[model samples]
Target chain A: MPQISQLPEFYVSQIFWMLVFFGLTFLVVGRGMVPRVLSTIADRTTRIAEDLAAAEHARTAAEAEAEAWAETEAAQRARAHDLIASAKHTAALATQANLATATARIDAQVSAAQARITAARDASLGEIEWVAADVAQDIAQRVAGLTISADDARAAVKGAFTHG
Target chain B: MHQFQIEKLFGADWAIAGHSIAFTNSALWMALSTLLLIVFVAGGLQRQVVPGRWQMAVEGFTGFIDGMLAANIGPNGKKYVPYIFSLFMFILFANFIGLVPLGLIGLHPFTFTSHFSATGVLSVMTFLIVLIVGFAKHKLHFFSLFVPHGTPALMVVPIFFIELISFLMRPFSLGLRLFVAMMAGHVLLEVLSSFVISGGNAGPLLFAVAGLPSFVLMVGICALEILVSGIQAYVFVLLTCVYLNDAENLH
Candidate 1:
């Protein structure tokens, strides 16, 4: 039953306030909030990317260090083996040289001892020959009891030797 | 003076305290709208995935809301999905409900007091709720939201005061937009429909002539109203989100 004539005058003011409300809301929403949220998102993404990159770098470096260590250990092992082989070789050569020197010294001493023995044996043989001659001459003189002259003895020895 | 022909759509017996309320048809339409919204949403929810026609409609609404949040609030804006979604759905439901043609029976019951209609009450209530939500979220920053950044010291104090006044005006703007649109549509429809009054001898002929234009206009307006209803609902929610954004971010 409400008539148009009774309509309130507040409608005009209502419309005005509506426009004001819209303007302020738009300002607050668009300029103030959106940019901050967008920036935060960008920052978070960038940080994640940086973290991932750092992790990758660390991984690669560790791998390289491990490879280098393995290579160095391999080279050290080879060098140690070579050192052991070379030491054994030197030891073997020294032992051979020492054995040769010892043998040579023994040979020289044996030669000197053989020379001394030959000399001593000849001196004894000479002494023994002299004694044998003296005995034989004494025995012959006693048995025959003949003391003939020297010249006669000489001539008889020569004559007997020619006849026999 | 010409005698006023009192043409009542309901029988002459239909009255509220010996005066006609014209509420019967409007009430029926309102109830029908509410029922349709519930049925559609419930049926859609039940399907959940692998949606049928009804379910697809609901999913479309949800997906659209998701896209809006992601675009406006960023990918992390998914956090506020439920709040935004509920705001959108409720308004959408209310607007769609307004479109049902229950003749003169569709006016809301609870919103009606001794003086004002329920539709008007709903608009004001919705507006206040949005304002409070914004305030609760931002607190002090909500007040700062109106003042533009990078103002000079001389300009700052005046601008701050103006901003404060403007900030206080939000609920009025939000509620009136919806209320005006709805009230205008309904009043226009009612006036047009009244022209096809059934009077004794001239009823049929008069009804035919007036009914054609009225029906055509009503149909055209109805279609437009459907679109307006949906759009208004979206706008309401969009503004709410914008307010929420201001409060939280302070810019």
Candidate 2:
């Protein structure tokens, strides 16, 4: 084969070029490129880890804030309930006092009105009795030609009202 | 033989001392392979956190080599990643580039690995590294690689010599395997192609008998050639790692 016969002729040239090319290959691939690729991968991993940590931190803070807000809301709710209860109690007391005062005033006014009505009725009855007595005296003098004094006529009328 | 013939690219051979050093077809292919390798390596060096396809492919190869070295040589293998990575990719690219049938387009695809001179240099390089690592790391204990573990005292000496011979043969064996496989495959294709041509020139019956079957076989072998290229590249790197393991670990 020409490969055997021609070995002495070409081996040096082949080896020379090979070493030159492969040596450069090693430099570019190993020295130049690999470190950069590895670094990039490392950077990504770090960034991802940091991002995850931040997310966890934010979540924890949010949970704590929510807890604080709940406590405040609960406290506010209790305070509002207490205020409402006290206000309701005060309103009830005021209403009771107003109702009692109104009832007492109304009672006094009614009693005064009752007293006036009783006095008016008594005055009307007295006038009516006097008018009846005068009528009786005049009738006795005209019909019987009897001389009758006003006092005696009154007494006779009273005796007749009392006897019936 | 014609495929294997080397000619002067400059119409003259460059000689150093008494040896003829010519820029030949083999040198041209070597340069082409290296150029493409640079492009491939450069394409993948985008250095983005999330890699593009080119970068991913580059990572995939590097990762594959890293894993292999880690498996074979273990913890101390980290330092050899670049060298091993280059070796694997160089072989893989050369093997694959050769199998590309550029002949159909009136161009010859030369497999430089098929040349013993080229394969020999690569094997010697791997062998030298193994020697250096073996000596550097384990010192004199690296000599224990010659004898298998658990041998009887009586058989130790003989086993050592035999193992030593095989160990010595490693570089040549490595070179020979690749050179023969690549050279033989190309030669076979050329021979079969010749048959198809002769059959076609003869008559329809001969064409149907020889050309057709040979054509079918060529197609089948073309597929197999693609497979072999990958496998051979894998085997070469695997053996390198194994040899390195012996040197590194003294097993």
TM-score of each: 0.46, 0.76
DockQ of 1: 0.01
Worst 10 residues of 1 chain B by lDDT: B109-118
List candidate 1 stretches off by more than 4 Å. A1-164, B1-36, B46-49, B104-139, B196-211
Which docking band does candidate 1 fall into? incorrect
CAPRI rating of model 2: acceptable
Candidate with top lDDT is 2
Model 2 iRMSD vs. native: 1.7
* Candidate number with greatest DockQ: 2
lDDT of each: 0.55, 0.84
Query: Each candidate's fnat, in order?
Result: 0.00, 0.69
Q: Against the true structure, candidate 1 has what lDDT?
A: 0.55
lDDT of 1 by residue, A32-141 (tens): 33233334444556878899999999999999999999999999999999999999999999999999999899888888888888888777755544444444445556
Distance from true position, residue A143, model 1, in Å? 99
Looking at model 2, residue B109 earns an lDDT score of 81
